[model samples]
Target: MLAIIGGSGLAKLPVLEVTHRQVVRTPYGDPSCALTFGHLGQQNVVFIARHGHGHSLAPHEINYRANIWALHNQGVKGILSIGSVGGIRADMGPGTLVVPDNIIDYSWGRKHTFFDGPERPVVHVDFSNPYDDGLRSRVIAAVDAAGKQAVSQGIYACTQGPRLETAAEILRLERDGADIVGMTGMPEACLAREMNLPYAHLCLVVNWAAGKGGSATVDFDPATAEAGMNDVTAVLQAMLS
Candidate 1:
């Protein structure tokens, strides 16, 4: 089965026909909340909110290890993670939907790996490509099928958060070849990799990055976020099916 991890503007899947909710406990800890099992256009799927249901957890505080473990234990083969991002590339701005091809992690202080404890063997997983290529192709096809113009690939910059990045930090990220910036993409992506589960990121451009476009002041318009989510949800549902 497939799994969906919702972040920020998306806490629940409107397209899912709810069947039940399951509470799971992993060796790491409890997941963010109960996992919802349901159908999206004839496909059975599970979903969990990356942040808590009330949007109470910050990116830095998320239990990504537990979340990934819970889904993996449940036999989920692939995961689609959705979150809001700040646009860094010229063509990616508000209301844009993108499936990132690569990522640069600048986040710290979060539990990053499943092989940290003593009982586990010193396992080193290859991470030359963070996002799964096959799953990304499915997403790109779904975007086109849903009639939305979604960018096929870009570089995601994951930063330590609870706080937004400084203009200088964003500039550094751009220099590092980042095309989008957000807080929640690091350990979550890595944890999924450790689980041997294929994962893909579907990002919504909520605003411009700190040093780019309209983010000099504040331009995270709610209307744009809502509209973008509405458009992408259709594609996501199609992808699941």
Candidate 2:
């Protein structure tokens, strides 16, 4: 089965035919909220709102371990994380959908790994390629089949946030080779990997990075961002069906 982890613009699976909701408790603690089970056609899938039902959890405050662990223990074979991001690459301008192939972790002070303390031995997992390739291909194919234009690959930069990036910080991230910027991409991706679950992200380009495009002086248009999410949501629905 697949587990869909929704972020930002998506608080629930819009197309999921929800059968029931399950509250899963992990050794790491509770997940963001109860997991919603349903059939996106014939497939059995689960959904989780990463920021809790009220969308109150900050990116730094999200307990990524419990979220991933709950899904893993429930026999979820794979995870598809949907995130809203700011574009740094010109081609990845607002309203674009991308399947990120690589990621740079710029987040800190979060419980990132399951391997900790005296009981568990120190462990290092190879993160040379953060997102799973096969799963990425499936999503790209689904987008194409859905008649949506999606960028095949891009580099994701994960930042510590409740706060948006400064113009200068955006520049720094661009120099770091990031094509998109967002919160909630880090430890979640890594934690899924630690659990041996194949994970891939479907990113929606919600806006231009701080100084680029229209965001230099104007406030970010969240309405436009939400519309962009709708574009990707269609593809996600087609992907599952």
Candidate 3:
């Protein structure tokens, strides 16, 4: 089965045919909430809201370890993580869908890996390519099949925040080659890699980043988010089928 980690603007999959909800305990602790099991199109899938159903948890407070472990423990073959982002690249404006090929983590002070403690052997996972290539291909193809267009490549910058970035910080990120900016993309992706799960990120550009698109301040529209998520649902359905 595949797992979908829903981020902001996507607390749940409305199209998912409900089956049951299962609460799971992990060595790291509890997941954000129960694992939602259901069918999307003809495929069986599981889902979890990254920030909890009520959007209570901030990006930094998320239990990344438990979330990934619970899904891995449930025997999911792969994971598709969806997040909302601010567009730094001019071409990637509001309401755009993008599949990031690389990531730069600016986040800190989070439990980023499971390789801690003396009992575990020393391990170093190669993150040369942050995302799973095969899964990325599948997502791109699914977007096409869904009759939607997604920018097939871009760089994701994961920030440590409940707060949005400052204009200067956004400038620095752009200089560092980040095409998009978001929170909650880090430890989650890295933890999945640690668990040997094929993982990929699908980003929804909700607004222009600070100092971009001729806007000094970032602004978001609920309607844009609604439309973008609608496209995401269609792509997910195609992926499942």
Whole-model lDDT per candidate: 0.91, 0.89, 0.93
Over 1-241, each residue of candidate 3 has an lDDT whose tens digit, in order, gives: 9999999989999999989999999999989999999999898899999999799899999999999999999999999999999999989999999999999999999999999998988799998898999999999999999999999999999999888888899999999999999998998888999999999999999989887864524378889989999999999989988
Q: Per-residue alpha-carbon lDDT of model 1 for 39-141, expressed as tens digits?
A: 9987889999999889988898899999999999999989999989999889998899989999999988899999987788888999999999999999999
- Looking at candidate 1, what is the lDDT of residue 190? 91
Q: What is the TM-score of candidate 1?
A: 0.98
Best by lDDT: 3
TM agreement with the true structure for every prediction: 0.98, 0.96, 0.97
C-alpha lDDT of candidate 1 relative to the true structure: 0.91
Report the C-alpha lDDT of model 2 over 27-142, residue by residue, as the tens digit.
Answer: 98888899999988668999999999989899999999999999998999999999988899989887889899999999999999999989999999999999998999889998
- Candidate 2 accuracy as lDDT: 0.89
User: Cα RMSDs of all predictions?
Assistant: 1.0, 1.4, 1.2
Name the regions of candidate 1 deviating beyond 4 angstroms: none
Count backbone overlaps in model 1. Answer: 0
